[model samples]
Target: MSAAGPLPLVGRRVLVTGIANEASLALPIAQVLRASGAELVCAGLGPTPYHGALSTAAEQYLGGAREAFESTVREHLGADVPELIADVTLDPSLEDLAETLRLRDLQLDGIVHAVAMDRTIRGGAAKPLLQVTREEFLDCMSASAYSLLALVRVLLRAHVLREGASIVALSYLGAERVMSHPYRNIGVAKAALERLVRELAAELGPTFGMRVNAVRFSPWSRSKAGGAIPGLEEAVAHAASRAPLGNADPASLGCEVVHLLRPGLGVTGEVRHVDGGYHVHG
Candidate 1:
């Protein structure tokens, strides 16, 4: 509705996950996608009710993250839209996802996988991954890396996504190199996630005609997840100095993901860096 007709993503059914607030990368992507004419279905791990109903466990599981999550969804997509309870850590049931999509009566055109976590068992706190415990390493990998595979597998099984569906996940430069404060096993997990994206491009491209990729983002404006990091502000300032654009902004990355999700692009199975070219210079 920007006076240029419906956005390119208009009429597309896109599902996005891992949104915690209005500033979250996923929400920005959803906002842009919706503006461009894409219908959206937001999935989150929060315990918000669906259509005025919630399981006892869900109410407890959402813990303290529910209110913010609900408010965020309302801000981005408005109230009264479908928001599903989904945990990327668990293998999502295709039937459940399909049933939810059926309720919306929208064909899946793209998926955004933004789920991630670190139990801090890494013990390194913000230290490098080499110092982390095996449990910490695997836990991060399961939450950040393997979840992409699970999501795509479930969607593929359910035949929910249409051909040319784009799958995107978020990553960071630390996944390939070392940072001063260290982020435990997150770097290794990101590397693994990128690898999986490439492998999935090969495995699913021909079979399902879908594309898989990840965006490597630098530190950005603060969020609850980023605030948990010990020296995030310093990291952002450092990246800004080295970055071509002199800053890392989530909005830019959100726009980039929307571009990848749209049709008429040949990019597939690649890790697109939207970090102000910081990855290249640094």
Candidate 2:
């Protein structure tokens, strides 16, 4: 142990998913896990440094773009942490992810599910729920909500998740209630994700000795997804104005993640709030 005491996540290996850019929320969480003494394996939506990990579909999804993803890892996640290319929507891609980790012997102690996407949430105006196509809605749901199940199952079956491991996913206030702007499709998905967190917690906790939880953060506007949302700026301002401690920052969010990932905690099935008391209001 160090001078003070043992670090919270000493000797733990963590996988952090959903880092799309430097602005991504996952960056801060990954940083915190490192600070807490956990080794990290990062998975991003797009390309990886290893060409063997990219399939044809993954290539298409990336739109042949590499610079942006490359920069995110280099600048934020560092050059040492192995950044894997894993798209939860594709089973084969996930298979490859497990294979890659297996070859490298990356048995994880924790996973941060920080990925969410909604194609219907464009910038011009709010796409009405009625106007949203079935394909659009289901795609949104699959990407944002169901991907958690897929990712976790594959990892588990591949022997990636170790015993006594933990999982944490990012969510928002719009998941359970209406907000100032239209969060329609993705909000619905977030509700499903939170529900999955509870269900997974109950089942996985007993069987695998694992814990699962979700954290609902403040109205953040810096992310690619949040910045795309209409009225997000206004919502951020309003939330900060109304919140007792003001809007929470990414550093605080990272701390909460570390708390959840810390071993020996019986905490699970919880929808923890890191929104600076914004959830308390009507």
Candidate 3:
């Protein structure tokens, strides 16, 4: 089919990282963004032909992952939406990704940094900081915290972000608060991330009119990282009860994010909570 003209996100392109499956929050954001007329380009940790982690197992496990995701997204958004691949963890090189998109005539209107990491140190090793390795803790900070800064850096350096661009990163309640031991480094990383979002928003808003923000979600069993958090079920259930509006849907969260990405949305540098009312509860 011939490519259609620009639609809400028309004339705009978005770089969404960390998409895993259809049920993933990123997928829904992609969906809503597409519906709003935005072109799509996805990136992720490797195991896929697109961008992904370099680890053999990650590649093996994530194999065909990007292709499958592209197929699914295209099927839903129609064949016109574009997609791309790149690994965010592979920092310094991330700038090349923007150039890659430029080759396709896609200028970024927004970026979604949904990437995060926790040392799969479950069980005994998942204990308090004393039980965790220095390397593991640093990895968590690098993956979950610095990755956001890295994304903004690459986009800024590449000039891929259009004026008034929106950057959304995910955080959790555990960052400011706490859940348990296994969730340690991630919480610290998130706390750092929340601060980073504000700083970026302050800097970018003045320089480029770009909006930076983080979305804090309650425990949701959609991603592998989330499922690994022990006592997650209880946490989510408690959150649902505390929420004045009851449970929050991933798709709904995506819709809110879509609105934030648009220019003149008048929202930025804020930590938007998609956790129902759980944060308010306690």
Better of 2 and 3 by lDDT: 2
Residue-pair clashes per candidate: 3, 0, 11
- Tell me the tens digit of each residue's lDDT in model 1 across 1-282: 468655778667888888887767778777777777778888877542232466677566575465666778987689855677665665534346666776666578898988778766323246454566888778888888998888777776666779889888888877788776556577778889999999999998898788888898878646656666777778889888888887657768778888889876788998888888888764
CA RMSD of all predictions = 3.9, 3.2, 4.2
Error of 3 at 216 (Å): 1.0
* Tens digit of per-residue lDDT, candidate 3, span 1-282: 015434456667788887766656677777777777777888765432344336776666556766666666667656766656655666644766767766666778898888887874464345576777888888888888888888788777776778889898888888887674357777888999899999999999988988998888767865666667777767678777778887788877777777678778778889988877677865
lDDT of candidates 1 onward, in order: 0.76, 0.87, 0.75
The parts of candidate 1 lying over 4 Å away from their true place are 1-6, 47-61, 92-95, 121-124, 127-131
What is the Cα-based lDDT of residue 121 in candidate 1?
31
Candidate 1: lDDT of 173?
79
Q: Write the per-residue lDDT of candidate 2 for residues 1-282, one digit (tens) a residue.
A: 246687899899999987777788888888878888989898877654344566678777684434565578778767888878776787778878988898899999999999898988776467888899999989988989999999899889899899999999999989989787999989999999999999999999989999999999998889888899999999999999999899999989999999999888989999999989988898
Candidate 1: worst-modelled 10 consecutive residues by lDDT: 121-130
Per-model TM-score, in order, reads 0.87, 0.93, 0.86
Which candidate should be chosen as best, given lDDT against the real structure? 2
> What TM-score number comes out for model 1?
0.87
Range of the 10 consecutive residues with the lowest summed lDDT in candidate 3 = 44-53
Off by over 4 Å in 3: 1-8, 47-59, 62-79, 120-125, 180-182
Instruction: Tell me the spans in candidate 2 whose CA falls farther than 4 Å from its real position.
Output: 1-4, 47-66
